[model samples]
Target: MSAAEVSVRRRRGSFGRLFASEVHLVFGRRRNQVGLLVLFGLVTMLGVALKVSAMRHPGDRGGDLFSLVAGNGVFLGFAGLTIEIALFLPLAVSVLAGDAVAGEANLGTLRYLLVAPVGRGRLLVVKACALGVGALTGAVLVALAGVLVGVLLFGAGPLITLSGSQIGLGDGLLRLLLAALYVAVGLAALGMIGLFISTLTEQPIAATVATAMVSTLLWILDAVPQLDWLHPWLLVDRWSAFIDLLRDPVFTDRMVTGLWVDIAYGAVFLFAAWLRFRVKDITS
Candidate 1:
């Protein structure tokens, strides 16, 4: 290969290695591991609780989509995702995204990393990719854990849709995976916001809390009936759109709108993060 070709290949190799290192650093931390465990544990508990409730009251189906869990184990994944998207998933994304840069700065290692050949923009890209992966991982873990526990306790089979129709086991699982991915996309948007926040502070904890609080605030605003006009603009407003995936015909309107909103938020914040980090003075 020519020198130009060789240089391009080397750059690609370096980027891949850097991305792998960042992913490893994110998941390798004890706190992140505990956070993932907590996510899994919560889903498992939800499954067990539903199983007990079903035994005590054969007619009770819990409530909402959760009610369907009594009939099919697959709904447990949906139920778990619903509960997680409300708060836990955002918090998990915040922890990773919020710490993406602040954590390195806090440890006095960011400067050392910057001293390498990688540009700041490339580093930020790697960090964003790692955060996205981490967010997706957490979402998938909850869905998988819910499915495993639900199947073990209740048993899996055809899923009953909200439209009062049924889908085969394979289709149901496919929808479940789609739902997990949808939720992850929303979480990834949240991560972008966290990434921007991380660029503003060296304290990872503060950035984490701030990023989480932003989600909490959006959720609170979304709950207000008078704010119906503003609901469409809120980031957390359409997070529950994943439920549409469980429908028989599979509603895509809300999911499509949600995807657009997520993309908008992600792109805006990601650009803002890049802009801020580009001029950010690394003191550590």
Candidate 2:
């Protein structure tokens, strides 16, 4: 290969290695491991409760099992998701995203990394990607645990959607996957917001706490009856839009709006992080 070809290959190899390293670091952290374990534990506990409900109230026509699980075994994943999206998963995402840049800066590694072959832009991209993967991994684990327990306890069968439509098991699973994907995408905006906050401070703990507080505040704001006008524009407003995926017709209106909302939040925060990191002094 020519010198140019060799250079291109080397650069690609390095970028790939960098990404892999970031992923490893993100997942290997004790906090991330604990976060994942907590999600699994929550799902498992919920599965047990659901199983008990199904047993004792087997004759009951209407209950949480029907509304949440939709009278299908696979819909149990949806039930787990319903409980998780409210707080559990968002907390996990915040942890990784908040620590992404600030952690490195706190450890006094950010300055050296910038001075090294890693460009500031590349570093930010890597951190953001790692944070995204961490968030998505949490979502996947919750879904997997929910399905495994649900299948063992409830048994897999036809999926009954919210609109009284019956779908095949395969289609149900597909919808569940889409729902999880949508959730991951939605939480990614939170990750971006945390990433921006991480850039603003050298203390990782401060960033993490700030992100969590912001998320809590958003949840509180979303709950206020008088805040109806702000609901559409709030970050957490469209998070539950994933529920539409479980519907028979697969309502795209809220899903599309949520996607765009997530994109807008991510784009704005990412730009802010980039702008701040571009000129900010890194003495630590």
Candidate 2 residue lDDT tens string, 34-62: 88889999888887877787677775656
- RMSD in Å for all candidates: 1.0, 1.8
lDDT of 1 by residue, 1-284 (tens): 89999999999999999999999999999999999999999999999888888898998654478778888888889999999898899999999977799988998999999999999999999999998999899999999998998898889999888888889999999999999999999999999999999999999999999999999999999999999999999988898998898787999999999999999999999999999999999999
- lDDT of model 1 at residue 129? 95
TM-score versus the correct structure, for each prediction:
0.98, 0.94
Off by over 4 Å in 1: none
Single out the weakest 10-residue window by summed lDDT for candidate 1.
59-68
Off by over 4 Å in 2: 1-7, 63-70
